[model samples]
Target: MQFREIIRQALYSLGANRLRSALTVMGVAVGVFSIIGVMTALEAVNKSVETGLTSLGANTFQIQKYPATVFGSGHRRNQYINRQDITYPQALVFRKTMEGKASTIGFMLSSQANQAKYADRTTNPDVVLTGGDENFSASNGYPIEKGRNLTTNDIRYATNAAVIGSELAATLFTQGENPLNHSIRVGGEVYRVSGIFAKKGAAFGQSQDNFLLIPITRYLNHVKESGSINITVEASSRKTYSRTLDHAVGSMRITRGLTIREPNDFEIRTNESLIDSFRDIERAISTGAFIISFMALLTAGVGIMNIMLVSVTERTKEIGIRKSIGAPQNSILRQFLLEALILSLAGGLIGAAAGTATGNLVALQFNLPPIFPLLWITISMAVCSAIGIGFGLFPAWKAANLNPVEALKGK
Candidate 1:
């Protein structure tokens, strides 16, 4: 028979047993869905991380009491917690010590889930209240859109001057009123607006422009006392970044009074390091997803084999009739195999569509753009084809080699 005729016959056979074909297809779909869904979500997160996680400027790094991300055992976590806080005093000393070594040194501290109010307008209790210096804008990638940044006088005198993020400004001054020089209450303390930060957009579904920055000194005194401070340092150029980082570590060690024999207690975080860490996590998640998908697909393959075997048995009389009418063994084998291929491919296509849609939903939650994992979809389809052929071979062989006399007798 022509290939087209064989294909037509195979499809008709599957259509005749719609319920069974659908069930088998669903099994394959489940396996493909698991891998594709996970990969799509992770790809979205990776895209966001590459763009949004660069909270620091070029050739810059930060020193903090805790690492940017924490993992591992309880003991490891406790080790970080047990280390002494990077006090404001230590920050001052480090800044003074590294004055000429780096281009700019900035300090910051923060509190979260704070409310902001202006006149009759009030914002949600999700604003980030940060304490920063004049260098805060440059170091942290937030530039002033209007008004002036916090000055030395503001930090030295602990003035109640604040710079508001774009989202927060819009929330409090919705009537197009000027936000600059206006007074707003944050966490019950009032501060005059000194500047407004440019719109920074959202990351990981969270608004980056929903924060308020005040002088670091003011934050320490009013928001929280005796807490760790984060110090940001920017190297003059990429060529000097390594040297600058080395000097920063030594200067911080001296400020923290760490002897040469003692290990550094604080953490140093760079944009590259942060991205690398995230990549490691992404790899781990991908590996786990692949393993689960492999197992699920394996089970689905077994199901396809069993179903094909049953199909051959039920169609024995029909096979006998076809063979008696001069049908060849290869033709019968091809027909059976084609049915399995169609079943597997149909399931793969359905799974791919569903998985892509589901993955995009996760991206939407984070305000990330949608992604189509083409490579994964192709791989899934290929795997399904393999499953179809590998599993369907035995049944096809059995049907092709059946004795025409016994099959006709319904044996």
Candidate 2:
């Protein structure tokens, strides 16, 4: 039989056993769905993060007591916990030391779930309150939309001045109301609104403009005294950025009182490092998804093999009659193999579509754009085709090698 004729015969056979074919196709679909769904969601989140990180500006890095992301356990986890807090005094000293080497060095800290109130209207307790120095806005890419930024004097005096984000501004003041020079209650303390930040849209479903900012000194004194602070540093020039990172590392070690032989106790995070961390997480998730999909496909492959074996048995008389006439062994083999390919390829197409849709739904919840994973679709179809060949070969060979007289006599 010709290849097209073989495929046509295969389809007819599959159509004859509709329920069995559906069940077999379902197994392959499930396997494809597991991996494709996970990968699509991960890709969407990664894209969102990349865009958000780019808005943090260029040649900037941050220092903190602990790494932004932690992996591993036991001694490594405890080591990070045991590190001393990056004190306000230490931050001030570092700022003084790096005066000529860095463009802007800002100290910052934050408290979440604090309420902000203007007269009778109060925002939800989920509001975030941040404390930073004069250069905080410049270092953090927060452009002042109205009024002026906090002055050095504010940090020095630990003044009750505040800069609110655009979202917060809208919440606190009426449409035409100028928030500058107005007092609003944040965490039960009244602070004069010194400036309002430009609107920054949401990332990962969380609003970037939902927080209020105050002087870092005021934050440390009133919000929480003994906690660690994050220090932001911008390089003086792009040419010196790498050297600046090395200089900052050495300076931080000195500030923290670490000896030559002692290991440094803080983490330095740059835009590149943050991206690398996220990629590492993505790899881990991808690995897990691969494993789960492997198992599911393996089971599906077995099901295909079992169903093919049954098909060979049920069509014994037909096979014998064809062989008794002019049908060749390879023709019979091609027919069975074509049937398996049809089932697997159909399942792969369905599963890829379903998985992409499901993953986009998850991405939508996080306010990320929908993504169609073309690479995964190609890979799934290729893998499904391989599964077809791997599992179908034996049964096809069995059907082809059967004794025509014996098969016909079996009734």
Candidate 3:
């Protein structure tokens, strides 16, 4: 038989068993979906993290009582929890001691799930509330778009002045209405808006602009819980970042009263370190997804093998007649293999489309733009093709080697 005729016959055979073909395709689809969906979602998050998690601004790092993210035994976690909190007084002392060594020093404390109100419009209670100093904007990259940032007087006097994010300003102020000097209630305390922050997008499905900043002193005096402060230190230049870190570590240890024999009680975090932490987490999840998908694909390959073996058995007489009529063994093998390849490829395409759409839905919820993982799609298709060849080889070989007389006699 001609090669074209063999391919036509293989497709015709698969088409004849609609239910079996559909089920076989579904197995491959499920396998592909498992990995593709996970990878798509992680890719979106990775993109967001590149821009969002690195908000510590250039040449800046922070010292806080606890690590940003913790994973380990209960004892390890409890050690962090039991460490003495980085206090406001301690931050001030560190600032004073590191004055000439650093370009800028700032303190910040925050709370979540607080509502902000203007007139009758009330924002969701998911608003973030922060207390910081004059250098907060410079340290964190939250530039002021209108009015002015907090001053020394605001912190010294414990003034109720506030700087709001772009989203919060929009939520509280109408068109042509000035947000400056407007009184807004946050956490049940009224404060005059002093500045408006430039627009900052979302991070990890949370709004970065849904926040209000006040002077650190005012936050400590009224808004925030005690001992929840973090100190930010900025180096004068990129070349001095390591030097600044070393100095800050030494100063913070001294300020915290830690002896040489004791390990440092505080955690120092920079933009690069934060990004590294997230990458580690992403790698772990990606590894897990890959293992799960491999197993699923393995099962799907077995299913394809079983279905192809059954196909060969059902078409035994056909194969016998073709062999008797001068059909080559290679043609029989190629036909069965093509059928398996087509089945897996079709399922992969379907699964990739469905997984991409589903994963983008997760990104959409976080206000991130849609991403089409073309690379993943290509890789998935290639993997599926490999699976088809690996599992279908045995069945194709069995079909090609069948004895014409025995097959034709239904033995």
Candidate 4:
């Protein structure tokens, strides 16, 4: 028989049992949907994080009280207990000592989810606020869209200058009415807006464009009220990054009065380290999803096998009549196998489309753009084909090996 004839016969057989075929297809669809959706969403989110987090800069790293990628309990408490708050003098000492070795910078952060009000327009509490020096722009990568960057003179005298992000600027000021030179109340304290930052969109779940940047000296002297400080350092280049890190470690050790044998108390965070933390979390999630989807798929495969067996039983007499008349055993086998393949392929396609769409919907919650994974598509199709062949084999073999005498008696 022609391949077309085999396909035509298989399709006709499937059509005869429409409701049963549809139900089996639906079962497969549900199984495939669970896996493809989650994988796509995660991949898109990972890509978005890489792009948004690029601001951390090349060869640049930060030293803090805590590890960027922490995995266990008691970390927050240990951060305060085992670590020392980096002070202004320590930062200055590093600067004076490592002037040619590395570019040392100091900054302080005071974040409050306060309302930005201008004629009743309000913003969400996730607003970002940063306080830093003239070196902040070079160190943290804040690009100015309008007006000038904070000058050294601004920090030397503890200026009340502020740089507003694009989102915050639009929320407070009207079009053509520049926020520069205007006053914006932050935590009930008014400060002159000196510059505007370009749009930064979002990173993970955080909005990068809803921030206010001010001079660090003013922040420490006036805002903090505690007289404490946090210092940030940037390496000169990728080539000198390791040397810069060594210098900072030694310098912090000296400033903190740690002995040569004692372990370091400070933390240094790098971009690679942060990405590794993300990857570790991703690995855990992927493992769980794989186990769940695999079990569900195994159940669905069992369902397919049972349904195919029933289909062979229902068509036993018809199979014997065809075999006695010109249909070879291989032809009968091919016809039944192709029906199972059709059933699985149909289900898989529906599941893939639905899963891809659903994944993007979830990812959109974090402002990550939708992504379609071609590799995933290929893998899913191959899995569907394997399920069809694996489960459809016994049923097809039983039908092909039927006794013509018994089947003829039934007919």
Clashing pairs in 3: none
lDDT, candidate 2, at 243: 83
| Total clashing pairs in model 4 | 0
Among residues 3 or more apart in sequence or in different chains, the pairs in candidate 2 whose N, CA or C atoms overlap within 3 Å are none
Q: Please give the range of 10 consecutive residues that has the lowest summed lDDT in model 1.
A: 49-58
**Deviation (Å) of 228 in candidate 2:** 0.7
As a whole number from 0 to 100, the lDDT of residue 151 in candidate 2 is 96
lDDT, residue 269, candidate 2: 86
Candidate 1 lDDT by residue in tens digits, 1-411: 999999999989888889998999999998899899999999888887877766776699999999988989999999999999998888888999998899888889888999999999888899999999999898878889999999999999999999999999999997668998899998789999989999999876788899999998988888898788889999999999999999999999999889999999999999888888898898889999899888888888888888899899899999999999999999999999988888888888988999999999989987987799999999999999999999999999999999999989878
Worst 10 residues of 3 by lDDT: 49-58
Model 4: how far residue 163 lies from native, Å: 1.1
Q: Best to worst by TM-score, what's the order?
A: 1, 3, 2, 4
Q: Write candidate 4's Cα lDDT for 178-257 as tens digits.
A: 77888777766667899998786777756788888888777777767443355567887788889998988888788778
* TM accuracy, model 2: 0.91
Estimated TM-score per prediction? 0.97, 0.91, 0.96, 0.88
- Which model is ahead, 1 or 2, in terms of lDDT? 1
Give the Cα lDDT of each candidate: 0.90, 0.89, 0.89, 0.79
Candidate 2 minimal-lDDT segment of 10 residues: 48-57
